[model samples]
Target: MSTQYTYTAFLYWLLLAGLIVFFLFLSWDLQLFQTIFVQDITRISSLIFILFIAVSVHCGYRSWFVASQSLMLLKIKKLSLDDLKLLSDDAFESRSVIKDFLSKVLNSHSEPDKTLATEVLAESLRGAHQVGWFMAGVVIKLGLLGTVVGFVLMLSSISAFEQLDISDIKELMQQMTLGMGVAMNTTMVGLIASMTLGIQLLLVDRCADRLLLETIDFSLSTVDLVVDNRGEGGAPLSAQK
Candidate 1:
């Protein structure tokens, strides 16, 4: 499979951004931002928004990194051994998983060790998105924390109940409304942010997988050639047994 998975990833991100923008505009028109973010005393929704923005930026950068790796894979697939050797270290992109695997393959004294190369590549790439995945889950947990806090606030309003004075009843009602708003708003924002980030990371993972498989295939075929005269008294690799 050609590791041209970057195009699909890019299109998915573009559409996702457009949808988010449309909903944000609608929310602004409806004045829901003030209700969900500004009025809540807990400010959990605001925190969630901030965290979401940070994760989104990280995920975008990761996507670009994967795309660059894909392009490099395509380049390596086309280049001959002499061509690859002639190219300087600076010619390949930096911090590329494929580049690392390719370097190891070319520098190996014997056939490329596919198992070792794949393990290294997998671990390196997994680290790239592991933080984003963890943070996405944290966003959901923060929302749940807000829910607990909101409920505590609501219960506190009734904790000092004494004969329900007219003024006391009005104050209790106001507190209850604020508490409910906080709970609902935070939960809603958390779910949305977590799901969005999770999807983006999922796409990045898929692209990474394609890149890995294609790289392995390319290396085995062209880059990781077995020594044709190694097995027994100058036997060729194919006639070795």
Candidate 2:
């Protein structure tokens, strides 16, 4: 399972890298970077937007990987206590919620203790989804920030036209137009980044939900197995025999 996760993560990153490179190539071919990044306003916003996109993509991949692992676990129709113990061992050797929960269960002697551990594990799983959501909000806020900055710059450019000289009007108008362009470019970049990241985050949220459900079900099964092994009087079956 650890190997599978590692392979999945590797493949996801590789695909992401390829897509980023392809996007860069396409932007270069379209001369978008040259035109949009010509000014400080657009350039800075674009850089921030790109950074957020990368973070969002990485977060999405992590969520997907975790969810995929949980889904795989759900496929097993039957899992005995020994099978679960082995799985728990593997999980402990790696970084996984299943391992943490299983470890807690193995150490816990009562149903209430196991239930508490399960709750803790669920919280841990939720942390990942929360991060994706927070980042998605940040991406949108950055875009809005760029929009405000662009408009401020555009308004400031109006000072150049105060003289109202006919001969200089053309140049002033050109400057004003440039400022508007900066404003629009930043706005566009921000919106595009926000929307793209929003979609990714949405998917992450869905996967997280499914993963949580499966984890809960698995924990319940583990609890039942432990209870059953203890026999009717809460004593080990082997002791009764």
What's the lDDT for all of these models?
A: 0.75, 0.62
- Which residues of candidate 1, in runs, are more than 4 Å off? 1-6, 91-95, 110-114, 223-241
Error of 2 at 211 (Å): 1.7
Instruction: Give the residue spans of candidate 2 off by over 4 A.
Output: 1-24, 40-42, 64-79, 83-95, 106-112, 229-241
Clashes of 1: 0
Give residue 209's error in model 2 in angstroms. Answer: 1.9
| TM-score per candidate, chains pooled | 0.84, 0.73
lDDT by residue for model 1 (1-241), tens? 2455546556666677788779889998999987788757878889999999898888777777777777767666555454555234765555567877877776665544756777888776657799999999999999999899988888887886866877788889998988888888898899989999988889888877877787777666554243342224433322322
Candidate 1 local lDDT, residue 124: 69
What residue pairs clash in candidate 1, if any at all?
none
Best by lDDT: 1
In candidate 2, list every pair of residues with a backbone clash.
none
